[model samples]
Target: MTTQNLLVELFVEELPPKALQKLGNAFANVLFDQLKVRGLTAADSVVTFFASPRRLAAHVTNVLERAADKDVLVKLMPVAVAIKDGKPTDALRKKLANEGRAHLADLWPNAVDGPDSLVVQSDGKADAVYLRGIAIGGTLQVGLEFALNEAIAKLPIPKVMSYQLETDCELPGWTSVNFVRPAHGLVALHGSTVVAVKALGLTAGNSTQGHRFEAVVSPVVLQDADSYAATLRKDGAVIASFAERKAEIARQLAAAAAKVGNGARPIEDEALLDEVTALVERPNVVICQFEEQFLGVPQECLILTMKANQKYFPLLDAAGKLTNKFLVVSNISPEDTIFVTGGNERVVRPRLADAKFFFDQDRKKTLASRVEGLGKVVYHNKLGTQGERVERVRAIAKAIASQLGDAQLVQDADLAAQLAKTDLVTDMVGEFPELQGIMGGYYALNDGLGETVANAIEDHYKPRFAGDALPRNTAGVVVALADKLETLVGMFGIGNLPTGDRDPFALRRHALGVIRMLVEKDLPLDLNALLAGAVPAFGDKITDASAQLADFIYDRLAGSLREQGYSAQEVDAVLALRPQRLALVEKQLAAVRAFAALPESPALAAANKRVGNILKKAEVEGPVDAHVNPELLQEKAEQDLFAALQRFVPEANAQFDAGDYTASLQTLAVLRAPVDAFFDDVMVNAEQLDVRMNRLGLLKMLHNAMNRVADLSRLAV
Candidate 1:
């Protein structure tokens, strides 16, 4: 029950702040799980994980003394170590020499002098067997560096390097994992003892130094982890929690900005805040003023310039108009305000001026005129030009627009998709790649394009992350789906499917984007047919990769549906037909979900639980031709179910044909009561082969009705 506080510090040559943060967190998580699995428990364990440019550290407190007591331990020895009849061999004789316990080796002391260290000696026979009474060490430290390396490699840390030595590499990006990022170094410790931790070009050690600016060479010391962190804060001045650092920055910024002009608005940029927090240790908020002339530039362009180039937050007045002031988060203390403020202001001025020039340049030429120039710009070496992609998108848009049944949405698809990539060629987008879609939409709107076209330009890149927002406009959905689908189809056709997590073209994302559009937008999209046509229209350029490409998209469908909380079985059932129609697949998936939630539970699906009896027997009897012969319907349950089918079929068929799948499913749910009663009250095997086959035929008819909606039997209610 004895408790311990543990600290591990890894000092490297300036780790990127993001990587440091990830490493810190990964170490904390890996150690927590590792201890738990080993039955290490404590009253409490609080771990503070933090990182700086040069160090990664975790401070763990109230940890159990050691891993829980082990019930068993077995050590494997080579056949050369075991003599005939399971006696200790001469090798054991020599090993006993060190311990001064060689009673059994007295007869063979001279025979063990050979230095072969053989896995199996030249005995006439050799055997591998478990030693009955092998015993070993009492406890282990569970090298912290080993655990940290594993977890860090899994984190989304970029700029991983590759050391030339094979043994030095902790991870194998060159050998083929998911990504290309390389690992640097790891520092593992148990309490305060150093441990080895090398895997993919990384080596583990005990010593870690502090930040270069303040606690430069005061080797961060800890009797255990808790005390180690206290030393860091006291000496290094590191704000370990990025969120904590960010909040501190915000509070200071608000107070500073209020001093300039009370009741002013604070520009929120959660992303920019995080990035800025990474670059600093102690933060000071600075509010600086710029000339009013810069306000004449497009606010978005100016904002992007300020945030991206200079890492400054814009200030706004009560009316939401851009103010002359900007708030800068400084890394140094208040005494260094003059130096930091001047430096940031100097950097931002040129960016705003460049944006002003670009805005003026873009005003002279419309995005509409530039749309044709996209043809000359290369989209891909194999896929021809960006202009050609626009053409494919046009074809895709036309196809989708016909389904939309709107003239405006249809015509805007061509213009929107064409202009969607035009921003990729813009000076603004070139300066800030993240603004590609935003800038295009702005330009299209300024050039007098319709709202649909402008929105389509933006939404084509919507839902960029998991569970993010998606395009709401119909034209936007078409262009967005087309853009992603074309990339997926093209890469898939090139036999470049994502395997073992390696997707150079982000095919996974492209497919997920398509899934979101089809499901959320409620677009009736046949993904396979759509993607198949997408690559071929580029002049039969992607012939062999079509099948591979379809599979890639389907794999993404499984991922996206799972992300939405759909079970694997339901996904498989809907995808059973390789459903070209995403709407159809999702409809079936939803139907299965509903069936699962029913009160009677399985309803007809309960029959599947006895598949060995019902399905096996029915398949042997073959398909039930539901052409009612009336005389076959002798039982009351049977007659009622048959009549129910008759009543439900016309409506179900009409609903199914009209694409009212949910209504059709509700119509099928009517059979559940009669189905349960029939199974309970009547026996299908009636001591006559004709009767049994006839009943089987009836059951098959009901099953067929369920299939038209979705394979309800797949639902495990």
Candidate 2:
């Protein structure tokens, strides 16, 4: 088969910078996939995607001009109905007519279907008619058109813009189309030939416009698919590849920042980089500076304003401190670039001024005064105001602090919890909700609060997302855990548990945050006791969801353990005990893993499982005292197992009490021999009632001793 590389391009008005990367990738991948599906591409076809402010394009190698013809099999009705009297019957005629094959009925058997007659017997009665013939393959023109339409229709466009264009016909009138931008041109080329395709009211061609102001030619003509990139770069004065353009920008930014000296570097943000790359065709990095006094505002505020509003990269010093200088990526290069730098500097002054104003205005009123304002702010319709939520959080925090420390710690946590959400009502936080907890800490310092209280206020929202740091102090940890638990318990109490991906309350994150603090902090605080303490803080307004919330937390913990690379069996075995101290879970899992690797592990696990099943079936009345009367042991196996238990159980229990879980579990490996012998030789359900009960009591004692760290039966498999 003859093959050639394919080229496609869509010229449009400037696209949304944030969504441009995803749109370009989707367009290229979908076009290549659709072409491959139509057999117009080979298995090894390679695709390259191009995205810029004004264009989305793709180049695919190993695409075919026309797909090779393939044999297709068509099944028809039973042979008995079609081969009547050895001539075509009415039923066959109708079937052939419906398929547009009526004229070929005389040659039906001769058309294809090997030497075997079209008739095939089935069940000695019904026979299905078969037709096998070559199918005409698709051409580049047809396949390209289908692929083009599919790719455009499936673009991950954040928002669509509608425009009108004239129809390419005599009865011309404007037709409206909705796309990410108003597409003005399209190009589809196979080798050096233009493929016949139309999109957005334009026919495919081999030429497309380049950089709006720098193109040497009005329309850059591509010679072939392989020449697209070179042609655009040379004649078009534009880097057509997104990756190349981004790299060029990064290089220029680094060079420009180095020229600024003082060990200055551009603040690295990939999302900002991608957006800036999408906003320019030929990047020219320009250094711009503002007045130093604007740095009085928080660096986060200035940095966010520059990156979010102006699409600029703020320069940072070696100490990781923000400077007044920033880098701007421009689309044009001029001999004297003073105007571009001056213009960006002038434009950013007001944005920085507004941030400074918000910061100054926010500090004038201390956080203590802002507490009353939160009462007016609604946290949730079902959960009352942020003021009420703060009270609940304060109670939970103080209770947790009291459990962990002295009076001073409790006081610090109570104060921090009370002030944490007050920032949500502050001017700066109102402008940028991301600064809620941060601004609270700042305001607390200005109010002359102790460092511990201010720090706790800010750190209360720690571990907000995956991989984020936890609270830095004990008071902070207490307040943070309380705040998260308050949200979880309140929402769950009102039957607002998360369903699928609709966790509007972020219950999952709150649960994980609680788990992280308890485990990572190793606070010795009981999770159930904490939850129980939290439930009553609601004070009868919400139903009790303590049990349900505990289960939910355990489920999240199980998933978190699996994601951390623990096997399902290992996780199940450890979690089955439902150990209250989450900090011990990892240790328990480690212990179980070590125990399972012992030579006698399999037999012990199986024996533990069997013992559990027998005890469950017996459903013995009351707690069966594991104390066995030595005289009742009628078999040697039973007597031997009893002797082993008496000797080992105390040692294992001592180790467990001493927190030597690994050593404790490993010690039980010695019991496998005696346990197996007892199970193999003794009938747990013996006819003699006393003997059966004694055996059950013995197994019960064994089950209790073996499962202190984890449920050994879970490792049976």
Candidate 3:
């Protein structure tokens, strides 16, 4: 069969900007997959998708006009049941009738193994009667209709809208149509031929409208499948591809930024770019500006208002300071350009003014003044108000600070923690919740709080996401840790742990934040101790779930370590010890990796596992002592092992103390040979009770020495 390119387009009202890319991709992919499943796509078939505010379309290459016929096998029934005396039984004839092969009922007795024949074959368990037949090919019209319907049904529309078709008004009764948007037209072409298909009450055609106002023609007519994009662009005044349109917009934005001079550039926001791309069919970047006096507001406040409220890209100078200028991705281009730029500037003035007003109104009240309002705002019903949460955070912050720094640091941490959530009550934050912690810092400075305290208040929410920077100062670190810990402990204590993908509390993120601070900051705090200490702050409001919370944190750490390119074996070995000082985990992992590479690792690791198992069993019988009695070193292998441990363990301990973990593990490698000999020649469970205890003690000492850096047995294959 001959193959040709195919094109399909759905013309509709503007789609949701955030969901346009997904809808377009889903439409094209599902259509291509359905066609391939029906054998209408060639081996080399490929699909290209296009999406814009008003349309979603796909182009497929190497699609066949008709699928090729193929042989099919139909299993009837057991052979004995299908035939009687070499003649077809009634059951066999009935089965063939159901298969639409009733004419073969009489010919089956004389049938041979051919395209349309019946034969007896074993279907794994038993001999069965099979019908071999040739299936007819499907025409492009039929295949395209099915594929189109399937694609429509599968589009990832965020919400569907229901409306009455114009035709429905003329009928006896009204009929309603549901879709992401009201459908205006449908286009389906196989090569130059229009495929008969219908969707959303519209029949397939060769014509589609474009650029509601700028199109050279009212309806751009595509001549063939291969020329769809070019024809649309030439006559319709629209770019047909989402990616191409987005690239063009980026180029224009850059060019516009360059024209502004002073090393100006548009702030990079991919999500904003994508949303803008989805809002316009033809993009023209225009530079616009607001009054310079608006710069008195925090640049963050101004920048956010421009981007979030206006969907404009704020221009930043070489120093990353916001300039008065911004760029707008307009849907149309005018030759004069002045009206377009002036109109955008006029439109954005009120938005900037609102931000300035909120900022000015907010700075009137010091952050300390807002602290009382937090008591009225409910944080969580079970956790009481934000005021109560703040008090808990202050307690945790003071405790963490006392361990990490001097009294001044502690005071700063307490103050920062107290003020961190106060922004939630401000006018600016009430207007834009994303500016919560950010506004607090500004207000802190406005109150004449020292830069250190202001910085701490601002950065207490640092590292809010993955790869986000940690707190910039020690006080910030203390407060951030305390804030995150309070959330985690309170949520977990309330039996509100993250289950599967339903972490409404963002407990996973909070847990990861805690892990990042502890591990990356190399804080000297013990993980378990931190959790236990935070529990008292909750008083009767929570249970002591510190044990469960510790496991959660360690689990997060293990997953993070694996994602960072460490082997599962390496992570398991290091984390198995439940090392309290998370700062030492990285070093322990590195030491484990180094030890695993040694030639003696496999043997030593196996011996260590064996020793662990023996000691575990011995513990059930009584207690296993680490003190090895020289009198009980009767076996030559045991004596040699003890001598090896005596000779090399001290050096390993010293290296471990000095934080030279790799050296420590390497120094212990000397015991591998003696360890292997002891296991091979000595029986851990001796017939003599005293002798058995001594052997257990000897193994205990060896086990302790081997696992100081990591549980070496976990490295075993």
TM-score computed on alpha carbons, candidate 2: 0.95
Would you give me the overall lDDT of model 3?
Answer: 0.91
| Model 2 lDDT, full chain set | 0.89
Q: Per-residue alpha-carbon lDDT of model 1 for 623-661, expressed as tens digits? A: 545455568767898888778888897888898888777
RMSD of 1: 7.7
How many angstroms is residue 10 displaced in model 3 relative to the true structure, after the best TM-score fit?
A: 0.7
Itemize residue pairs with steric clashes in candidate 3. none
Per-model TM-score versus the true fold: 0.75, 0.95, 0.97
lDDT on C-alpha atoms for all candidate structures = 0.67, 0.89, 0.91
Assess the local accuracy of residue 625 in candidate 2 as a C-alpha lDDT between 0 and 100.
61
Model 2 residue 310 CA deviation (Å) reads: 1.1
Per the 3 Å backbone cut-off, how many clashing residue pairs does candidate 2 have? Answer: 0
Candidate 2 lDDT over residue span 394-476, tens digit each:
99998999999999999999999999998898778878888878888888988999789988999999898999999889999
After TM-score superposition, the amount by which residue 486's alpha carbon in candidate 1 deviates from its true location, in angstroms, is 2.6
**Candidate that would win on lDDT:** 3
lDDT of 3 at 495: 93
**Residue-wise lDDT of candidate 3 within 176-230, one digit each (tens)?**
8989999999999999999979888899999999798889997899999999888
